[model samples]
Target: MGSHEAKPKVLILGKVDFAHDAWNALTQICDVLNPASTTREDFVKECQSGKFDGVVAAYRTFHSFGITGLIDQELVGAFPPSLRYLASCGAGYDQIDIDACSARNPPLLVSNVPTAVDDATADVNMFLILGALRNFNAGMHSLREGKWRGRPALGHDPQGKTLGILGMGGIGRNLKKKAEAFGMKVIYHNRRQLSEELSGGAQYVTFDELLSTSDVLSLNLPLNNNTRHIIGKPEFAKMKDGVVVVNTARGAVMDEAALVDALDSGKVFSAGLDVFEEEPKIHPGLIGNQNVLLVPHMGTWTIETLIAMEEWAMENVKLAITTGKLKSPVPEQVDLQ
Candidate 1:
């Protein structure tokens, strides 16, 4: 059949209220179908049946059995080859198996709303930093237990302190602005050096130099082969004694066991985490540490960020319908490639 004669059958493989009038705008352009939930059987059946032209993989609910600690292959096995494009409805594609998706015949087009998470991520990073500095988690629990004190431990000031960023992506740039606003000396280490003009008062530095000189460090790099456990015991040992650390990036980006040890030994003064190596099941040692602050992976949970992400994700899906392409295409070097 001719392309114009055949309408694309777009399916949402996760729970999304596309039925909402505002969200249904795309339905006017294609035959939209959203199953309340997608099981392995359902996904395979749809693909084998040649039913869908594109799919919006909602990252929030698109977890496979492996990620959920269920059977691994079963969840991944459900993906249908019928999908020409997969639109990730969030800032990151960590949930979707991009490599497998790209191996398809036409090469699945993977795209994400990468910009929407910047403000929210910056806020969360800042929250973690302040919480760690003030020992907020410990003090809050103590206060709830009626252990009132004249004053809690003093917190470190960001002003005039060296702030180091592990990666200088969108979130890192936003954070650099925030750090500079507080008079913190910002420095960073990235695989590729950004132009000096856009470094946001952040000096380019060697990884070791960043670790040794910074009073505070925030990791913003993507999780990949070279970066997995990028901050382990060896890296931690290079940092100044009593340095503060915060991670708002992917969980596995740091070595949880090493971080716990640093906290215990006072090699690190305090740490804050919005993500973990094994999410939902954080390292138990950090749980009881008075020097650590933990959050349940809420870096991009703000209302504005969610709305912007959903809208941009829908726009990405719409691009496939109109041009047979994706706007925020996953780079060829990404795992999905």
Candidate 2:
């Protein structure tokens, strides 16, 4: 058989449920190379030794490659750089080094599953907001412990309460509609103002006003150089006392240390966190606290979202192979960092 007749080999790293759909989609078009679960070391060793023309990767694996410095010599350096693309299954390409790949041949395509993630994240944000305001987790725990005899009073109504949003992206705008449904007066701050339609009924406010006046503050901003530790000591100190904070955004956006301090001093009433600065490794200070609730970065873990992400990623990889293009290219508006 001619070299051109041979199917190009594709590699996928890590686990994605319903992966059969993704696997079939690729193998139907190209020769597929995949192992069920691969550790960082195995991943590096395999990518280094294997021959792959393209790779469809999980964002988590990219982070592993990033931290372990395996992306360079392994995936990126594999096969004299005739590789077609490195498509990330999730929205945040922060886990990958896009700029480095941009300089090489057989251009890498940085794509993401924005639609699925946005919906899942929006739902989680609202869940956190409602849960914190009503003390759902705490109350449930107290009830289960049979300590409900002298439990605290019911929470203040969300209706007419000020809802502050730190960013006005897709998830933020989605939360705005849900908050309004609960009769909240929404205010938001973003690097750039949102259009009237996307802004919903929320008012645009200065960061200071958002901090000092919001009854419940929801973070939807990304994690980056400027946004890292954005909700630190000074910002938390300026917030209204006992204000509830909900972070479904990246964990670094809210300073874990500062949040712990705020909760300790009663500056903030409570916090609902679905993500952390160092994920899978929680902050020791906040773990044992009764007032704080933690979820293991599961804002986008719903089955529906997971399936959607896998399908989108698989489609992109297939498209890149067939048409020399990507379906879900990362937009310039998004901070690639």
The most accurate candidate by lDDT is: 1
Candidate 1 on 1-337: residue-level lDDT in tens?
Answer: 3667755667664545332444678677677765532455555565555443345332233344332322123334454555567676766566556666565565666787777799899989988887887668777767777986434456777778888999988999998888788777889999889987778557999999999998999999887667889999999999999999999999898999999999889899899999989878978898887668888899987766777777777777778778866778766524433
lDDT assessment of candidate 1: 0.74
Off by over 4 Å in 1: 1-6, 17-22, 35-80, 150-153, 333-337
Can you give the TM-score per candidate against the true fold?
0.86, 0.86
- Minimal lDDT window, size 10, model 1: 65-74
Root-mean-square deviation of candidate 2: 3.6
